[model samples]
Target: MSPKKLFARSAAMIALTTASFSTFAEEVNIYSFRQAFLIEPIMEKFTEQTGIKVNILFANKGLIERVKREGELSPADVVLTTDISRLVSLTSQDLTQPIQSEKLNSNIPSQYRDPENQWFALTTRVRNIYSSSERIGPVDITYQDLAKPEFKGKICTRSGKHPYNVSLVASVIAHEGEANAKVWLESVKANLARKPQGNDRAQVKAVKDGLCDYALGNNYYLGKMLADPKQVSWAEAVNINFPNQNTTGSHVNVSGVVLTKYAPNKANAIKLIEFLSDDVAQQMYAEVNYEYPVKVSVQPSKLVASWGQFKADTLPLAEIAKQHQAAVKLLDEVKFDL
Candidate 1:
């Protein structure tokens, strides 16, 4: 035990200890299709409250395979996606775990969550019509009215295969019956002001360009357009309408999250999801994304509130996921090119 040998041993011990301490630091890994900036505040809040660092991999594509490839080695504790169909796909593939959070169960409405707790809807958005403020005067329009001959060649929408469109069409099927919904879809297809092409915001732009008098858009798109300083003119050109309020109300969709089946940090993941379901986080979700908080007690953003309240189709959103294949087939039959 000479001085040089003792010094070497001490250094080796210190290195090993540092590595061990680093491994022990609390962390939760999340794979989210939602943009990093959009969910940063929530992530920060979770970290601040629980002192657990969240490592997020944010990508819109290839995340599913990445998770599958990672398999038992996957570090992802939770996944956040925008639609029920996508959530269902993940669960069907056995990539997600059933989360049993009482807070989530109590806060989220049954209509907004999976029956088996495989996923939970965090926020909701309605698929409603956006009309040109100057060209279209104040008038009520129903999803049914979109098929009217008077509106032919005056409507715009995104591609039919899109989950939003699929779910929207599914709601029609649930409400109007398949045969009637198919007939309505065909009629609406004939009315396309322009070939289905672009995201919801683009539909608004088309309306601005006078390519069409009206467009189908989700409520959040209107919120994003209105919030964008550069898109102020685009915002000015259109007015929001919650269709069929006096009848069946407007179509709605959700942003939901699920725990990974092999989550290494189940406790932390449960805490994170529960935190998101609570009032403060729910309010942040509504204000930041301009979406309706799933929590009934949480009010919509001021901009959303201004649009006024409307009934939303209560078809178990799981049905939208279940009927997604049928919706896609119908969209194809109707020839919605996007």
Candidate 2:
């Protein structure tokens, strides 16, 4: 073969390989505690924009422990969590790295992100009160108000140790002192219609079944139930009430993300996180999952909006997270589940 022909062939092969790499640059592996359906769309959009595929491993528990066990060899690029405490837990374990991204910083409000930039809340869910339509009329209630004498034997909830309830309880500890929060938990526990059992939707169902008149549950579960054909009736029997609008604002928890300590594809992972915080992804979070966007510019879904607005507590997530152990201990102290 001639020298010119060989040189030309080599250049063509090099260009082809480079273009192939550019076309599918990398894949970002996510260890997500969030349900697959809730976040898959946002990830699809990220891939569409950046050409970086997302690989998600979704589970109900133990993702953080898995990451810790894997250590530096962990393939996780980002850890996606449905609650603020896990994000803080991942950070506390030194399993995540601080990211300094202006895009991330600007997109997520300071109130909804880590002071050190280790975790960025993509969306927020309100732990709302579901009141029986037949028993309770349009009523204004607060989280603190539920513990009053009149509400005894009127509340339904899941196991108090569940992350959702713990986060809410932790928020209480944040807003009030630990002693006051403990007393309040005891009062609320005394109000339970039965021993704490079932998921959030069951609490709503319990209201419909007349098992209880008021249930503690996350606001988004109402949307989940509304979409389920069989559970639609259970959903219709309750009114979504964002409690504490009159005081310290509604107790809100976050679904957040962290940059893992062993992110092999760090650049691609950062792009995915940036995409999630952008206006488009924020809109998807509200529309797809009925959660509030962390971005101030993005509006909540119409259904979520129709529930009307409530002031979201601005307490830093870290503050609430710090109280998680105390919340759990108090639940055990009160035997809230029993």
Candidate 3:
């Protein structure tokens, strides 16, 4: 089916063919946490290069639960999700199985792929600090700096429990240990311009609206906001800062994929995974999603490169994943979002 036609059917159109059942021989079913718009062009390119058909079911939640419920009957040949924590959760749930592909191993960095090969990060994004161009001027900062008395009532962030913040917090725990991370979390909360209350873009808008001087956000959202007519001013109002360049490097996250535990179209799924890991598709993933490709050979988009590249935190994401619960509890303990 054409990309337009595939999109027209949407999630309602995905056929639930079990491993024991059959739908289309050359087709693969994707259970994606990512929106269809982001993947359609890449899927189109995949189809153009290979005769394989891609069917998608896009969901914001419950994909893992659904897969588990379906057991071997699940039609999901692949699962694509954002955030290492979600990938870790899926692996812990046993919804995914390992894929030992040389192409995947060669293309994706070891730090971004599961040690067990259950999931591979397709692209990366940095958690960044957006400084007001007018008020802040040039700035040098770190994740730890957000806690200082100088920044009190000057920082804007979303809920501390949100995955992005949690991941950063988890990294702090990984680096500083639980006790120091607790103190840091409290200090960060003490610095909030207002109660933690919105998404990453909202933090940027807070900077624009003069509600705050420093906002915590993702680097790619700068690209997204710049491209959005309504959000362009927000992007313009702040200078994107890749934090911790002088320290341990900025925290990085990924949008990744996994082969399902019982992928009916295993061959096609592997082909899809390999396609995404290569330069062409990695480029597509970077440009389309405003993210950094996990493949070392693929360059980030011009807009992203304009943000000034820095060393991504080399801490294995798995280590951060392990501290997620501790980070979330720290958020609750600090009442960071309250």
Candidate 4:
């Protein structure tokens, strides 16, 4: 070939290579409600395996509205959050797409994943109660027992309106029906030492302050308290109890993800979801956050298993999604404020 022609071809090839590299450097934007520290390791692993950078926008609130406002211009390729109701809201609003992956199907149980596959449970946590070891004699067991007259003015919980508590209420309504659940909530509320005004961790703090005998909380708070050197005393003050073991077992919730309906990189999104569902990634999620791995084969961390095996209410989580409206109504009817 002529020298001039060869030079021209080489210049074009170099230009194309540079352009491709620039595009490759761009990140996969994610709207995640999870704190970065909790999920950053998994993101790093994903980047290492696929060379696709992840840019997370983490917030505790307003994320859903932000995504909706972005409309067709939204840059998010995925959304990850910590509850079924939130995921269902996204799905019902047409914000996400149903995804299919053999690995995800095999790893996550059918009951935990959406029947239509719009979202999936990446990990789970059981809602349980913790009590002051010294103050509460004879260690009360079931969630129902908290409402007994004996425990009045000695209980602590986060606001009833919080999604965690709301979902728990919804689960009760599902199992025991609205009338009974309302009565239980009323009795339980009467037992509160103070008006519900704090987050779960704060309830643990209240327990330490001698303001309450028991605090309703998810299991991770205990793990987090134990893992933190500063919070060791708080952990010491509270004894974890897996509630309702004699009957319905503890209430469970999840941290899950869904594919954006208009994801610019749909194929890559599915690949990412499937990768997160795999046992390896699932285990990392569980360990990092003290959540239960969605993969059945992965064992719970020693700390979690030490609480003892308890039957989880096997009610399909999607039912909770469908009943979210009813849950909200009941929360209002019961005057559970935050």
lDDT of 3 at 320: 85
Tell me the alpha-carbon RMSD of every candidate. 6.8, 7.5, 5.3, 7.3
Query: What TM-score quantifies how close candidate 4 is to the native fold?
Result: 0.89
Residue 51 of model 1: what lDDT? Answer: 97
How well does candidate 4 score on lDDT at residue 42?
93
Model 3, span 208-286: residue lDDT tens: 9999999999888999999999999989999988889898999998889999997878999999999989988899878
lDDT for model 3: 0.87
Q: TM per model?
A: 0.91, 0.91, 0.93, 0.89
32 Cα displacement, candidate 4 (Å): 0.7
Count of clashing residue pairs in every prediction: 0, 0, 0, 0
Q: In candidate 1, what are the lDDT values of residues 144-240, reduced to their tens digit?
A: 9999999999999998888888988888887777889899999999999878888999998998999999988888887888889987788789988
Candidate 2 at residue 136, lDDT?
92
User: What order do candidates take by lDDT, descending?
Assistant: 3, 2, 1, 4
* Model 3 residue 307 CA deviation in Å: 1.3
- What would the TM-score be for candidate 1 when compared with the true structure? 0.91
Each model's lDDT: 0.83, 0.86, 0.87, 0.81
Worst 10 residues of 1 by lDDT: 16-25
Task: Choose 2 or 4, whichever is better by TM-score.
Answer: 2
